[model samples]
Target: MAATGGSGRSTVADLLAAGMAADGASAVVLDTAPRLTSPWPSWTVGQEAEGLAALPPDRPLTRSHVRHAAALRPGADRPDWHVLTDGRDWHSPPLTLPQAPAAWLQLAAIGGWQCVVADTPHPVTHDLLQSRCAGHIGLTRSWCELPYAVPVLCASATAGGVQALQQAVMALHAEGMPLQRTVAVLVAQTDGRLPAVARAGATMLSARIAAVVHIPHDPHIRAHGLRTVTRLRSRTRHAAGLLFHEVLAAAGASWGTPLPDAPRPAPLAVVSHS
Candidate 1:
C-alpha cells in the first residue's frame, strides 16, 4: 500500500502508530485488538487486501470487526485469523524471539525479564541474534522458525519494508542481553526507516525471518490524531492482539489441570517436635 494512500488504506507506518495508541500499549498486554489469522483454505493476497480495505475508516477496530471481517460476503473469502500456523505470529506491546545471548540473557532474567522471539529470518536479524547468543542454542535452519518459548510478531506481507525490518531485528539483538529471556517482536511497518545496517543485514539473512517490527518513535503516530489511519491501523492492531492472546492460551493449555497433591502429611511423621 502507498505510504500515503488516496483510497485511504493507510500505510504501514500510519497503521503501527494508530494501532499502538488506540490500544494503550503497555509493558504487559496492550488494551487493543489487532486482527490475527492464518492463510488457511488459501485466500488470495488480493482478496485479503480488499477485505482489509473494506473496513470503514471510523470503525472502532475492535475484536468484533475482526470476526465480522473474517466472515466476509464470499464464503471462501473468510480470513484464517485463528489457526496458529508456522508463519509469522504478531502481537501488541511487541515480543522478542530466540532467547537472547546467554550472558546478556542471564542478566535480564535476574531483572525479571525473559526473551521472546519473533519469526524473523532476515540474515542480518539471524546474525544479530546469533551473535548475541553465539552458536546455535536451538535456532533452526527451517522456515522462519525460532526456538521454543519465543513469541513471534507478524507484519504486513509487503516486501518493501524488508529493509527497515532488518534494522529492527538488529536493534533487538543489539539491545538484548545474554542469559535473559528476551522478547523478539516482529511486524511489517511499511514506511519506517530501515537503518543502513538493517538493509545490509537483510542481504545476509533473507527469507529466514517471518517479519520485523520497527517500533514507532512517537506515540502520537499511533494515537487517534491527524496523521493516523483509523480503520487500517485498527485492523492491524486487532490481528496482533489476537496473536498475543493465542500465544498465552497455548502456553496455558499445555499442562493438564492441576490435581490436588495428596495433602502432605505433617512433615512426614514429625517426631517429638516441640
Candidate 2:
C-alpha cells in the first residue's frame, strides 16, 4: 500500500490483511512507515518492533529469520497471520526506502504467506510502482495524487474531487501508469447519506477507474482505533470487502474470485455549491 501521508494507507493495509486471513490465507503486514505504532491493533502489544529490529543488516533475510522476528496476531482464526515493524531507534540508521522493499520481499518468502500487505511511505515513486509485489494499492485523499495511481482508493468525494480525479487520471495515464488498475474509494465522514457532490464525484471517478467503492463513515473506527475487520462497523466492513475484491481483480490476483455485477448507487446530479 502506498499513499501520501494521512490517506489511510495503513488502515487499508490492515483491512486487506484481515480479509485475506479470514479467507484462510496466510497473510502478513510489513510496516515500512516511520511511526512506532503497529497498524494492526492485535500485534501492537507484541514484540513486533523488536523482531524487525533484530533483522541482520549484513545477511540476506530468510523465512526462518522472519518467522522468528514476526509477531503473530492474537485470536486470529488462522494461525499464520503476523506483522513486522521497525522499532524506533532500533537500527543505528533507520532502514532507507530502497532497503525497505528488499526486506518486504524477504518476509514475503517466509512461511509461504498467501498475501503480504506492505504499508509503504508517502509520495510513492515510479520505481515503487514497478516493484515486484503481487500488486499495488494507492490511496489518495485528494485528486492531485492520481498521477501515482495504482488501483487507487480516493478517500474524499466532492465537486472539486470530481474535477481533480479527472485531471489526475489523465495525468496518471500521461505518466505511464495504467488507468485500468485504478479505483476510487469515496469515504463519507458522517452518518447521514452521502452528499450530492460526493455522489456525483463517485460517478465521475468510476468513469476513469475499474470501480468506485463508497465507504460509509463509521465513528467506531475513530473511537476505538484500528482493529481487526471483524470488529469494525458492518457498513465499513462491507465496503472494505468490496474495495479489497476490486483491488485484487485490478491486480489480476489469481486468488480473487469473480464477483457478480450489482447496480451502482444512483449518482446525484452535480450542482454548483458556491
Q: What's model 1's overall lDDT?
A: 0.31
CA error at residue 92 for candidate 1, angstroms: 31
Q: After superposition, how far is residue 86 of candidate 1 from its true place, in Å?
A: 32
Best by lDDT: 2
Using TM-score, give the best candidate's number.
Answer: 2
Evaluated at residue 8, the lDDT of candidate 2 is: 59
TM values, all candidates = 0.27, 0.69
Q: Tens digit of lDDT per residue, candidate 1, span 1-274?
A: 1111121122222233223333343111111112342222131222332233233433233334433333211211122212111122234332222233332122222222122222222343444457457655332222122223323323332353444444544544454422122222333333466455544554454343333234332334334332212233444456444444434343334322231221211212334647
Per-residue error (Å), model 2, residue 190: 2.0
Which ranges of candidate 1 are over 4 A from the true structure? 1-100, 113-148, 153-155, 159-233, 253-274
Looking at candidate 1, the ten consecutive residues that score lowest on lDDT are 25-34
